[model samples]
Target: MLLKQLSMSAILLYSSSAKSLDCAGLFKDAPTLVQGLKPFVAEIHPANVTFVPVGNPAYPDPVPDLPEFCRFGAEYNTSSTSKFRFEAWLPKSDHWNAFWFKVVLHLFELKIGNGGAAGGVDYREMAIPLAKYGFAVASTDTGHNG
Candidate 1:
């Protein structure tokens, strides 16, 4: 469905599902998210598609010494460094296990002033429900104004 036809609530719901998709299984389909988001977003594009692994005490810590720290799976086009980038930091079981919520989405710029547009998805609100569910999620602007 086109983004214009979708309600903000719908988009928010869709974005919230970021965690349900498995990066390992869906990395090859990264473009799908971009394509899906295009109609809704203006110039801003989904530069990177990341799949953060679910963090739990059962699994080894990503950084060892930082047993509380973990990393999720990520997917992106290494060639388009200037366009877009995304990353996610996972919380351990001791903290909020946000493995179900795909944590981060970073938007980059290829040129000056080429940043986020007004009609983009409400990622902040989209993250609220996840946070309410005890998920620790985060997203950055990558120093861009958007």
Candidate 2:
């Protein structure tokens, strides 16, 4: 199915088994999270840093004052001629609350975001603020280049 057809639940179903996701151990544990999913084609490698620093030249739109967080990305081979890609930012577990949902009193908050564009997944600007405030966020390219 194309990315446009997938519901948020369907996208998250692939990673439901990851009870606790942390950046420090992601380099070693990320593969297991994406394992056993059909059409899966993620080749996760060991990253040298726990988090990308502010103003790093590596990103296309670097946020100057964004807080450090763990960045994760993957691509799934949806078909012989197409691929779907996405990126997720997790607040460093040690630095802030990392839960996707919080239940305190009668209120619930889910901080995930679909901050992207039709041209590409551009979550950097949106993800930074949420990550700074202790929430995980994500965005997708809808299966194409920027």
Candidate 3:
């Protein structure tokens, strides 16, 4: 039984990680990238967006609720080969081009949460808003099952 389990684990890991697509290839055009993300955003809604400051004593505050949304990842296993992936979008003003990319990283923790039922927050709605302001966004599930 132990051998069986170990074999299964090895097979699973190899299959999942090996099937990843070249994610960078999808960013060829900004508009095309944004357009493709629309459906993904619509599927994940009513997400939680919590904000925490760096080097501050304030407990992370949940941003009442923004119009944005995100898709929560679920656990699963599969025999097929693929990788897991997703997208993140945040609104930006004209000036956002200057500092947006850097700031987006800071909010990743708040956006991704813990990847559990109660942890992950949806932010798909951010795609369009981000795109309209000249931000290119995209995501990939990579085809992994779990």
Whole-model Cα lDDT of every candidate shown, in order: 0.30, 0.43, 0.28
Better model by lDDT: candidate 2 vs candidate 3: 2
Per-residue lDDT of model 2, residues 87-125, tens digit only: 555554444453442211112244333333343445554
Summarize candidate 3's per-residue lDDT along 1-146 as a digit string, tens digits.
22222322332232224333222222332224233221222122333344322221222333344333222122222334532333333222221232122112223421222222222222332343333443322222323222
Clashing pairs in 3: 69-122, 69-123, 69-124, 70-122, 70-123, 76-146
Instruction: Mark the regions of model 1 whose C-alpha exceeds 4 Å error after superposition.
Output: 1-21, 36-81, 89-133, 141-146
What does the lDDT read for residue 88 in candidate 1? 33
The per-prediction tally of clashing pairs is 5, 0, 6
The TM-scores of all predictions, comma-separated, are 0.28, 0.52, 0.24
lDDT of 3: 0.28
RMSD of each: 13.2, 8.0, 14.5
User: 1-146, model 1: which lDDT tens digit per residue?
Assistant: 12211222232333345554333323333345444321211111121332222322221222211223222222223233422223333333444443333322323321112134322222343234333454533332332222
lDDT of 1 at 104: 25
Which residue ranges in model 2 land beyond 4 Å of their true spot? 1-24, 36-59, 99-117
Superposed by TM-score, candidate 1 places the C-alpha of residue 112 at a distance from the truth, in angstroms, of: 24
